[model samples]
Target: MMTHIVSKATYRTHMIALFMCLTFLWPCAICLYCTDFSRNVDHYCSFCNAFIGTYE
Candidate 1:
């Protein structure tokens, strides 16, 4: 019989990496989807057409 085991430290590291990736990617995806590049107007999201913010 063969057995495989994952160490606690390794598991924790993987979990932390996954959480960081999720936190970073989720917002980036939403931003990309909501952003409107067709119109060169105010910085407003296309989905809700809400002004996000100004660059300068």
Candidate 2:
């Protein structure tokens, strides 16, 4: 059996990439959804504000 080894740095990079992808996925999906149905202006604005981590 041939075993492949992954270095710590490579593993760390892959983990960070995966984490970033998952982290942004939800906000982006919500943003796109809000964009599609922008009839509710307040709803869109709130989600966008939440995405940017700011609320006024």
Candidate 2 per-residue lDDT, tens place, 1-56, comes to 22232222234344545665688765544443334222222212233333222111
TM-score of 2: 0.28
What TM-score against the true fold does each predicted structure earn?
Answer: 0.28, 0.28
lDDT score of residue 36 within candidate 1: 38
lDDT of 1 by residue, 1-56 (tens): 22232222234344545665688765444333344322133355656666565432
Model 2 regions more than 4 Å off: 1-9, 25-56
What is candidate 2's CA lDDT for residue 24? 78
